[model samples]
Target: MKINDVILRTVTKIVVFIILTLSVYLFFSGHYSPGGGFIGGLVLASAIVLMYLTSDIETVHKGMPFDFKLVAALGVLIATGTGFASVIFGKDFMTQAAMKLNLPIFGETELASVVLFEAGVAMTVIGVVVTIILSISEDE
Candidate 1:
């Protein structure tokens, strides 16, 4: 059976972009506000899920071409690395540092190590969620 899904695919493209943009905003705003790595990662995973829902796993994989397991491992490595970095510097584990730098684009921008940690967390969430979804889908 040839099912017609032109409208769904068209709308998905736009919706996915919006979701990804929102996810990025959520991630960046996390340090100062309610949103953070966990929520942002959830939102990101949702976007990926939406893509899978719109089409077959094979098709989505063609576009994304990601090994989710590796993604998860890398995320863990990154998150743990940040913590170990503190230890290497003779500080307690997971100790965070921040600094302010003046730049031509954004003046007096504050950069912190916590952002890296959050990024790791976000990547982990995305990988694990997608992997679980794929596993369940395969059961059918």
Candidate 2:
């Protein structure tokens, strides 16, 4: 199926950017608010899928610049590494530490190791979803 509608292509470009931005926002806010890695990753994947639908497979692949399977593996490795990092410090597995630090622009902000864990989760989710979409698209 070829998508030749210029309006759709233009709107897709704008919407894709918005969706990607929102996904990142959700990921960051998740540490303190309601959003989280899972939801954020799903949103990001949806944006990619939208692009895939609007463009050719080759174009989508070129834009991605990374293999989905490799991404999934990296995500797992990162999450595992984060979990084991605590062990190296004589702490239990997956132990999360939080600290409040004052920055130049951002006043006092709380930082936690769990953010890394969430990032891993988000990457894993995005990789899995994209892989699934690629597989299905290829099968058709």
Candidate 3:
């Protein structure tokens, strides 16, 4: 027999949103403070895992129709591509460049290649972690 979890599901909805919000904050704050892509990705993965814990795998998979392995591959490609771009410009591998740009919403901001690299790292982490979690759950 299955146990009813209406309350758990309701709370999960709110908690997941909060966690995702925090992850984004952590990702953006990495440039200035002590948070970054790896932590952000872990937080994001936790939200996904929480969802899975609250519901069935099929439902979660239906909502997130992504092949995590592909995600990881793409992340690696993106990260390496950023490095190769520096090489193409006669700089060392993984060289990061930054520039100041004035955008309408954010005003003057420093844009850096490190953000792209971090994004790739975040995606890779999310993919690998989620894949591992799913694989482990499958053994049940």
Q: Which candidate model has the greater TM-score, 2 or 3?
A: 3
Tens digit of lDDT per residue, candidate 3, span 15-124?
Answer: 99999999999998998898998999899999999998999788998999999999988988988899899999999999999999999999999999899999999999
RMSD of 1: 1.1
Q: List candidate 3 segments past 4 Å from native.
A: none
Q: What is the TM-score of each candidate against the true structure?
A: 0.95, 0.93, 0.95
Clashes of 1: 0
Root-mean-square deviation of each candidate, in angstroms?
1.1, 1.5, 1.1
> Candidate 1 at 121: error in angstroms?
0.4
- For model 1, where is the 10-residue window of minimal lDDT? 131-140
RMSD (CA, Å), candidate 2 to true, equals 1.5
- Of the two candidates 1 and 2, the one with more favorable TM-score, higher being better, is 1
